[model samples]
Target: MAATAAVAVACGAPAEEPAPEAPHGYVAGAEETAEVQSRLVVADAAGAVRVLDLATEEVVEAGRVDGVGSVTGDGRHAYLASDDGSVRIVDSGSWTVDHGDHTHYYRAAVREVGSVPGADPVAVHADQAVTALALADGTVALLDRARLDEGAVVELATIPRTPHRGPAVPYEGHVLASVAEPGQQFGSGVAVHDRAGAPVATIDEPCPALEGAAVTRRGVVFGCADGALLVSGSDGAFAGEKIPYPQAVTADERVREFRHRPGSALLTARAGEAGIWALDVTARTWTRHDTGPVAAVNSAGAGTALLTLTADGVLHALDPASGAELAATPLLTAPVAPGVRIEVDTSRAYVNDPAAGVIHEIDYADALRVARTFDLGGTPSRMVETGR
Candidate 1:
């Protein structure tokens, strides 16, 4: 990792300076060879950040962050939301850059970056090399991705808070944040703000009791008890359009959280004791589906299918558009601990079976079959695939 390499360099002579230039983003192409290393970056109860490589089926104790129990990350960096008022950022050093015919990859020495202070950095969203943190106190902050890599940060904007728990999702030129009326205790709507923390519109649309939020290729979507608010556009101006749920999704049955991936406009959520709820962000439509008492759900292949891991240990893949069941396969028989999560990408879906200290990689396209089981060692309550 980067920390080890740093200590070794200190015992050697001063580093030599070299010239570099790449047409794309940071780390220049000439300096970035095909050294791509992707893995499942996890934060555990032991304050440790572990990396599991699927190819080698080996676990690497990357590093540790005190008080880190869960994590979220893009392919380049993993952001740990501490219970305290600060956020810890770790460079996963696993990323890919497309160069037309070939994709250039690099394996950076993973290291800890600077921390962002807040009332509680509940969520961190990264895009186009920019990072935005939403705090439990309703503080929304914008930061420079380059500065984060340098173990420092450039605060571009600090959207004032009103003491709420939610996320500030970043887009091309703007951010979407949950809005709370003054003197109110919780968030009741969603609003768009400029990079300077100015409101893009005069009015904030109601989304009382916002629970789940996701950033898709098209825009941002926030789950609400009533329905959902889909924010589109960018720059200093944006629009929040309501995507009301159908009559079938009554107050007794609504998803509080949603999960989605890049390129896909569909978001999957657990419809509280009911089943799965698919929200099409682009079309702003809702599709009713069931995963049979699922513990977790996720989307893959640009919203082609929805994957879920039932509480009964069965994995199911459903077509996202029509809510049709595509495949089903039993992967486990043990009862989950309310922490099992399902994650999917273009091809496969990965399930973390912490009780067995293993991860089930399912072939979703074929028939939701267990392709391989990786003995990751230790209990990983949650995990995110940091490999592209």
Candidate 2:
């Protein structure tokens, strides 16, 4: 990933240097790569964080945090949210920028960028210019994305706290936020706001009890009480459409969090305890499968099986169309920790076994093959993959 050039000299004459052209999607202090530089950011409950390079198998200490309750990422930076209302940002030093027809990958030094005060951040979303962090307290904090790339946490603006639990996503030069109706106890719908935290427009869809949000190729999806709300548009003019469940669902069976390959249209989430919910954003449909007692669930998007970790600590790949068990492997010990997660990239699926202090890499396409297992030497309570 080094830049090189050859200069020619004739008769001892000094060669005139041509103007340098910046590489496409070039960022200062980062080296652009040819392939995705995938890295896993693993964190323990005590705040020890490590970045495991998927390609080199090298583990780099990304400093640490204090009282880490959960960890999340936005394809680049890992956000470690602590229980004491403080959040720390760790740049995994790897990421991909998708420009529709083309993409770019980058790598740099892994380091802890900075921290912001927000009690138990539930969601962290980013775009080209801003990062919006939605806390459990309903406050949304917006940080400058460019400064974050420079290892700094600069809060440009903040959307005041609301009564909802949904994420305020950073969309095209605006923020897609959750709003609660008067006299309502939970999120009633989504609203659009400018970067300065001022309201611009409210989507008409009444998405009561919104719990989860994800940005996909189709658009941004928010899990609603009755169904999922799909919001799509740009330039401050957006519209919402309701993708209601085909059949009636109880409160316990509703999807709270969604997982999928970054920018993929298909999403997967655990439905209550004994089922899996697959949402096809392109088809605008939801499919339910009776998977017994799931611990975690995710997929590599279209054409991949639904990868689920059951209560028995075994990983199973199920057909997304018919819910048939396609493959299975005992990846973890029985009675896995509650914070265990299944992270699926394009070619591999990863699961952390806290009890055994290892991360399992499964080849889902090859009948649940345990391709490699990296022993972390310590427990990784929570983890997220970057540089997808």
Candidate 3:
């Protein structure tokens, strides 16, 4: 990988003042790093938030929140939703900026920015200009992303509709949100809207019972009753295509939430207690790997083993191509707690054991080797990694 290109000067020429280094991928209060500066934003049931540095293993307090119902992250900031209908934003201080061919890593001081009245927020999505918070009441608040970076919670616009069950996705200067038909309780399809919250166009393909949504390199995906819907936009024109399951899937065994590395097309999710679901967005295919009683599932991307944690507290690495168990290791002694997750990066995968107050790090490529175990003092009920 090329970094910091050097310009040659003639041997006999007088040395000219070096041009000021360009401020490429620069953030106001962040320091660019030579390598990925990954950190975990972990929160306990009692609302205590902590930041664990992966490189130095140093844990630091990042303030506290209360009544946290759910937690989500956007590669940099952690969004914590409280039961009292509010959301708190915490800057993880580590992030990556990908320029297709090259990437840059940065680290800053972690802190809690502020809170917003979200009315029981379910998800948060962010892009360069907008940060959308989708609430359970079907109200989507579009916040200014630039203001959010400076510790402000400014809502630029609000899109109110019938109560739906998915996020209002920000994409290509527009927003893609789930839509519900009259008398329907859940979302039936997705619609595209301009930045001003005006409906622009609706995806022709119907996405019944939309439950989950994720942003990938190919486009934005929404989980439907029968299958998944992939939507992409270009120059204000949007289109959708359905990717149905290879076989019949019961409602209880459908893949809802998706997990994967940022910008990766390989999406993984628990397919009930039967197995794990892997969706290849680029190829428009879905593969189900039988991983019985899984607690969590994730993948680094294509060509990586599927990292799965079974309910019995065992971490198993399965070959994605054939669904064959390649390796396994027991990482926890206590019963696996609710909300356990397997966060995967290029080299390592992390699983939090709330009952044991520890997090296991596995080198996925090395036969699922246990590279490190972090004994956090408190229960990590919710955790998300930044700086991929």
lDDT values for all models: 0.72, 0.87, 0.85
Minimum summed lDDT over a 10-residue window in model 1 is located at 28-37
How badly does each model clash, as a count of residue pairs? 0, 0, 0
- Candidate 1: which stretches are off by over 4 Å? 1-37, 55-58, 66-69, 83-85, 96-106, 117-119, 183-185, 200-204, 321-324
Q: In candidate 1, residue 222 scores what lDDT?
A: 79
Candidate 2 minimal-lDDT segment of 10 residues? 1-10
Could you arrange the candidates by lDDT from highest to lowest?
2, 3, 1
Cα distance off (Å), candidate 3, residue 212: 1.2
lDDT for each residue of candidate 1 in 3-77, tens digit (9 for 90 to 100): 999988897867777766646645732236555555677766657777776656666776666665457776677
TM-score of 2: 0.93
Clashing pairs in 1: none
**Model 2 alpha-carbon drift over 4 Å, by segment:** 1-19, 182-185
Q: Estimate the TM-score for candidate 3.
A: 0.92
Question: Candidate 3: where is the Cα deviation over 4 Å?
Answer: 1-22
Predict model 2's lDDT versus the native: 0.87
Highest lDDT: which candidate?
2
TM-score of each: 0.83, 0.93, 0.92
